[model samples]
Target: MRLLLISNSTMAGEEYLDYPKNNIKDFLGDKPVKALFIPYAGVTVSFDEYEAKVKAKFNEVGHDIVSIHHFEDPVKAVEEAEAIVVGGGSTWNMLHLVHKNNLTEAIRKRVISENVPYIGWSAGSNLACPTIKTTNDMPIIDPLGFDALNLIPFQINPHYLDKNPDGHGGETREDRINEFMVVNTDMYVAGLREGSMFLVENGKINLIGKLNCRIFKNNVQAYELSPKDDFNFLLK
Candidate 1:
């Protein structure tokens, strides 16, 4: 999959269009962009206004925008799309909606078959894992199924190392991911610092950002990165 996976909304050294979008802009490089911003829990914007805003973003980037919602025809959406950007939300909820709308396969086909790039940030990144069972957020309700798109074999716990004054929480993001690693022995974890991203070029995974990245195997620190490099080990 030509996936642009970002850790969070903040881009590297900038606060404009979120981390993932920055990666996308680089990969697209003047190519037309069409996005599908998966809706929030109870948003009330009409389709026309949504389309207008989408058009605006595309126009700002000199791309085209084709607006589609979870409630609409996903097949048509994927077909018309040259590139797709999935926004952040509840992982369980978004996966359920994807399955409910029978969009998982169609989206995969678009990315894998049609060669369209798929950009996901936050919960969108979570959905690209093999399964969503290990996410830090409580799965409020069981989805149609928790199976991920499996774009990448490994699981990514984005937004790692949040700085908080009070250190009290049920479990740290790393802790939760460790719990999953204990059971799933094969998958590697990429601890993406905020503003960092995983870029898929020619079906290879590479690290892009201005920060160091940590690699985890069975929750143990494997290595750290400060230089710009492509992670072929993860791809293998």
Candidate 2:
């Protein structure tokens, strides 16, 4: 299986996908690929608009994409897709539509079984985990089930932060994961901060970006790991 799970698409003041465009280009390689894009996570933006924004970035990097919405048979689209790309938005909406379309298994077969490259960011990244329970998105819509694609064994908390905004008394990100660990004791959760991502290929995983990813597991002290650190342990 091959996956590029990004924490977030854009930085505070950066252009949309500007930081990862080159990483995307390198991941897809020199040969231009017409990736099949899943834009179901989009809520406020129309599918066309979402596709256009992503297409512009891929086009800039010598690749292109076609939104899955244009297909008559979504399952068939996944089966024949050269590569799969999922954009950021509300994970709830994305999984809702994914279950609604009966695409959960189809996607798993293509990416996990068939080795097609899979790329996702934010909510999209959350869908790659065993369950969407770790997502930061509100339950604006029922995801049909908490279970997700399960492409990776562990959970990813995207846009993870060390501290809450000033004066905000809400639980820190770590506190929530601690709550999750109390019940799901064996699971691992990676606090993927902004500008960081994980690259999984051939069953090995690597962290990408300058920032250290905070690792959390029950009964173990949560700690930070730099990009140079071996992340393959997470796959175990």
Candidate 3:
């Protein structure tokens, strides 16, 4: 199983995917690959519009993508795909559609068995965990169940922030994650900061950006790990 799980798509003041275009290019390699894109998470935008936006960026990086919406049989599409790229939006909507289409197992089989490359950001990253219960998105829709792709053993709180905005007395991101830890005691959750990502290939994992990834567990105090640190333990 290979995954490039990004924290967020765009950085502040930058164009869409500009920060990770090179990373995506390098991951896909010099040989151009027309990846299969899953665009159901894009609720605010039409699937076609989302596809065009992402397609443009992939093309710029010497890779290409065709949205799965264009296919009649989504399962067959996943089976034939060389690569899978899931874009960020509403986690609920994304998983809802995945369940509705009965694609959960199909995708897992293809990526794990065939070693097909899988890339995702934001909500897409959330889908790679054992379950989507750690997602920060509102429950706009029932995802049928909380179970996700389970491509990775741990959960990822993408676009993770250290604190709440100015003047707000609401609970910080850490507080919420602490709440999750209270119940899912044995699981690991990585607070993946913006502009950073996790690269998991074979059985090894590595952090790919300059930002330090925050780690959280039930009883352990939360701490930061830089890109230089080994993240392989999270896989266990």
Candidate 4:
């Protein structure tokens, strides 16, 4: 399986997808591919608006994208796609539509069997995990099931922060994750900070950013892994 799972889209004061655009270019290669885009996670904006924004960014990087909604058969679209791109928004909404449209298996098959490239950010990254149980998104609605595409064995808490903002009395991100660990003791959860991403290909995985990824597991002390360290362990 091949995947580029990003933590977040835009960085502070930067253009949409600016920080990762070059990395995206490298991943897709110079041949240029018109990727199939899944934009169902976008609840506040129209699919067209979301598609346009992502399309503009992809085009700038010598690639192109078309929203899955454009096709009548979403499953068939995934089957024929050379690459798949999932945009970030609401994790619940995205999985709901993905399950509603019955594209979960199709997506998994395409990426795993066909070796089609997969790129996702934020909630999109959450979609690639064994389950969306670790997602930070509020449960605005039911997703039909917590099961996701399960392209990756581990869980990713995208946009993970080390602490709550000053004056905020809410629980820290780690606290919530600790709660998850208590129940799912065997599973691994990676705190993927903003601007960082995971690159998986040919059964190997690598971290792509300056920041170190925070790792959490039950009974094990949380630790940090930098880009220089091997992330292949997560794949197993």
Candidate 3, lDDT over the whole model: 0.95
Per-prediction TM-score, please?
A: 0.83, 0.99, 0.99, 0.99
- Across residues 70-114, which tens digit of lDDT does each residue of candidate 4 receive? 999999999999899999999999999999999998999899998
The C-alpha lDDT values of all candidates are: 0.69, 0.95, 0.95, 0.95
lDDT of 1 by residue, 106-191 (tens): 88888888887787777778777788765556576567897978788887878777443486756666666677778887888887
Q: Candidate 4: where is the Cα deviation over 4 Å?
A: none
Q: Which stretches of candidate 2 lie above 4 Å from their native place? A: none
The parts of candidate 3 lying over 4 Å away from their true place are none
Which residue pairs overlap in candidate 4's backbone?
none
Model 1, 3: alpha-carbon shift in Å? 1.5
Which run of 10 residues does model 1 get worst, by summed lDDT?
Answer: 38-47
Residue 126 lDDT in candidate 3: 94
lDDT by residue (tens digit), candidate 3, 1-236 = 88999999999999999999999999999999999999989999999999999999999988999999999999999999989999999999999999999999999998899899999999999999999988888999999999999999999999999989999998899999999999999999999999999999879999999899999999999999999998999998
Query: Which one wins by TM-score: 1 or 3?
Result: 3
